[model samples]
Target: MFNATECIEIQVKSRHALDGRLEAAVKDLQETAMRSRTCGILITRHQPGHYTAELSDQVPFGITRELCR
Candidate 1:
């Protein structure tokens, strides 16, 4: 079971300095979540990857217009 009450907005950037891209990403996410004190993470990426993970649960990818401002 999962709780949806808490969340964090995560922005992912590909850095050349990090070893093992995917591994670094997961570690970074865990560290950021601990420091920020959040549960759910809304992840966005600055650089496109060769592969992408899609959610089976019908979460919208588009942001609300009000939030665009």
Candidate 2:
């Protein structure tokens, strides 16, 4: 089983700067969640390949007006 929670993440890609990019993504994800009405539980992860984004089951992506704020 997997742990579930609410979240929204913003991810960016970097070729030579993996650590830096992950760090930035974590910060960006927090900032993105903080500025909105979200509960601010975004989980940021860095992979060996392309960067990616995700929203949890409790916060699935869709037409949520508050998500923009």
Question: Scored by CA lDDT, what does every candidate get?
Answer: 0.35, 0.42
What TM-score does each of the candidates earn? 0.29, 0.38
Off by over 4 Å in 2: 1-16, 37-47, 55-69
lDDT per residue for candidate 2 within 1-69, as digits (tens), equals: 122343334344555575675456555555555455343333434444444333334553332122221
Error of 2 at 55 (Å): 4.1
In candidate 1, what are the lDDT values of residues 10-62, reduced to their tens digit? 33345543325544444544554454343323333434433222221133323
The candidate that achieves the highest TM-score relative to the unseen native structure: 2
TM-score of 1: 0.29
